[model samples]
Target: MKLNTVENLVRPVFPFTAIIGQEEMKLALILNVIDPSIGGVMIMGDRGTGKSTTIRAIADLLPEIEVVADDPFNSHPYNTDLMSEEVKESFNSQITLSQKKIKVPMVDLPLGATEDRLCGTIDIEKALKNGIKTFEPGLLAKANRGILYVDEVNLLDDHLVDLLLDAAASGWNTVEREGISIRHPARFVLVGSGNPEEGELRPQLLDRFGMHAEIRTVKDPDLRVKIVEERSAFDQNPLDYVESYRSTQDNLKERILAAQNILSDVHIDYDLKIKISEVCSQLDVDGLRGDIVTNRAAKALAAYKNEDSVTIEHIETVITLCLRHRLRKDPLESMNSGDKVDKVFQKVFQ
Candidate 1:
């Protein structure tokens, strides 16, 4: 289940491009990868819709990045913002730090995880006995600059959700004990998936996710059969099935890398920004997060398409996914949230 912990173990990861249907889910993941600062994605759908499989595939699709060798936090070799304090000290000392390339870390947060496990614990006993502060790095430490996924996120405790939101927003994890403190970079793309049939996530918590993608069982008979056959083929011979899609996967990876490089330079028109806010205002979104995430997601979509400017098409494509979950829910109303968002968008943008 851990990508970084087991090196000797070899397992076949299904190629991202080989997956069938779930266009919205795949697009949300790709947009986040192209721009991790879009917060993270909230995927709500039917059970067994390839949520976990798609997540793993996306991680495997990415190319390796350079990190300071043997660092628990996966500290970047030269990026101070991504470097741990310890690595920063070494960097400041002009030490020649060794580096290695590794696939992006994919950390799965189990529902049973405790606070101490998610956030590293300060070793008070070691501090008292040896007069040296010791810290046991936790899941957050290992997930730095990677993807942190929480399955069945609706079932996770609210306090734990709060901690995750805080760390995700701040891009850092701080552990304090007995007046001693330890902090490090915990920046990552936070992906959470759950079944809507089970229960809906709290609106406040759901709002924190930058974009929300809802998927359903593929109803097209031929497409469903294709998906089944593909899964069967992959299960029968994972390596060969994965290899068949190597060219498509490489193209996807190259697009992601290129989009990331040009994201900062991507621009959005001032009139479009005003229209985005107008849509949010008309929808009665609680806060400005919808407007901001919409702007960011629009820019990301434009970048993903290799365009340097955000247009109405980019906004139209991403606005529903970004704002649907942010709207106030009516217990008595049966209308779909996405439909409501689209209606508001079309009205305002027109």
Candidate 2:
């Protein structure tokens, strides 16, 4: 089966393993896959920094999910709550489950997408032609248990941003139209990338992301040349380049799956938890989100490292990602938000 549903013309993506630099962005994406409740990732950076490419490449590495056959929402057969009332009734009489080795869906939410298209719509054709009320699943449905990637996310309309934030928070999408209402599971890892120069995301929407990563061009001449060389080789022969990195990608995938399996069992240290809370308070972060996301991110990092318990090191690894986007901008401070996070981290954890 295809990894992700092909909603548009397809293109060969740069291999995730082959991409050089931007390790933080990659880690944030992987952690979300391991435990999606960590919230989605927001990658803010300059153009040509592989932000979009990294999001696309992740689709190739994710494992397939077991879902109900032909389910529009990719609903798991065993999760009755995720199913619609009609579907549950039908399942009472008969139940069928299928394993689809699909690409972890990486759905693009275009700037032009309307509410009707992003959220499911009433089936006008069925209503007019057959006198039946039906629901036409939309992009959110396709993104269930997957990634909803928005390029230039800062440029998205305020209303659309609000809609996405609501769905991200509630893990459900309910569409009401003409006396017909449809509800379905819309849980997804919301991956958004944008050049900060284009615009700033709404503060409310920005806070919804679980982790934030900043990407920039490689500065070192040697690394820059290597990045160019790798790109040239991939362009010269996409298939061959992908094959060369296949083993590394497979290994990483295995690690991610293992991490997911043990994520719940990974213990959070009480002292570390206190440190996390104290750090958030010191940073003057808006709400408890920083503490919550920091805890979750550290747990994910521990899981990624196959550690049974979270450590100050694990918390340090993720504190920046969890709090960078939530910090209030200080005009008098010369340091950027990320830099501020680093300074605070040094003081709090040192």
Candidate 3:
């Protein structure tokens, strides 16, 4: 289908605010939106828990970004390296910049996606026809300055997982194919969802996510009913359902933008930093990732709530999300990661 036709046929997404329950999943996604530098979020949960719904809603609600027009990677106007050589030449020839609202690209990495599809490939058509070694941007390029979402992430091939990890960590995609080398900024928020019953995620891959949130089916009858009703309404008339929640969605978008505006000014005092370290030390988290992620998540929460500084409350709210997957797993222990985090959190903060 034509792009516009496909987009037109696509039903409007259910608004973010309309999602019921799963507060941790919501918070983790919001935090990542507020600060992509917070790494990314890993959501492990049961099927039909709105994991995919919430992700699409988030993409729909994100504010638009400006880019150099016709740039395959959605390269920032000022970021020369991300632009094609033609765009660079146009810059010297007085290229006109344009702006348009876009639903932040949320590219899904499928289980069977090939390396070339993910990292892009050499333009064989151009090479064979015109003897030009042009490059074709791939999923990684398309995901630049947006979100890379992987469902059933634990089941992903090891090589693909490693590729994702490298992109997430380095914020760049460099593809050298058939002697044609290309590089571009591939900064994106990596979000993944999977069911643990399928299999455990690799520790290295698990550690890459800055925050981890586990969700379960809604147990409360009232909330479950509400969720069911909402889904039914959405399925009946997606456009009307989205319209009904537009105001709430706008409020959320405004709040996210406001938080981002004030995030740099939000402060974390030395004592709290020490406390964060103490908590990490007690938890036996490897390296300094947990501490750094914890600090970032705490500050992001404070910023999201329009606070000027990080506090114990902020730390408490974000500790579990940041440290959950970082803990060493024990085959003999059955305690939930959240419970372990809460225990350490209370002990350290108190």
- TM-score of each candidate structure, all chains considered together: 0.97, 0.92, 0.93
Instruction: Give residue 329's error in model 1 in angstroms.
Output: 1.1
Per-residue lDDT tens digits for candidate 3, residues 1-350, read: 45667777887888999998899999999999999889999999999999999998898899988777667888777667556556667776886766455668889998899999999988867887898878878899999989999999999998998898899888888887566677778889999999989997889789989999999998899988988898999999988888899899999999999999999999999999999999889989899999999999999999999999998999999999999899998988899888998998898888
Off by over 4 Å in 2: 1-11, 81-85, 97-99, 124-131
Tens-place lDDT per residue, model 1, 118-209, is 99999999898898878899999999999999999999998999999889989999999898999999999999999987788889999999
lDDT of 2 by residue, 7-119 (tens): 43355678888889899999999888888899999999888888888888887678777676777888766667666555676677685555355566779999899998999
Give the clashing residue pairs of candidate 3, or none: none
Q: Between the candidate structures 1 and 3, which one is better when assessed by TM-score?
A: 1
lDDT winner: 1
- Selected candidate, larger lDDT, 2 vs 3: 3
Off by over 4 Å in 3: 1-8, 79-94, 124-131
Comparison by TM-score, 2 against 3, better one: 3
Ranking by TM-score: 1, 3, 2
Error of 2 at 346 (Å): 2.6
Candidate 1 deviant stretches above 4 angstroms: 1-9
What lDDT, from 0 to 1, does candidate 2 have? 0.86
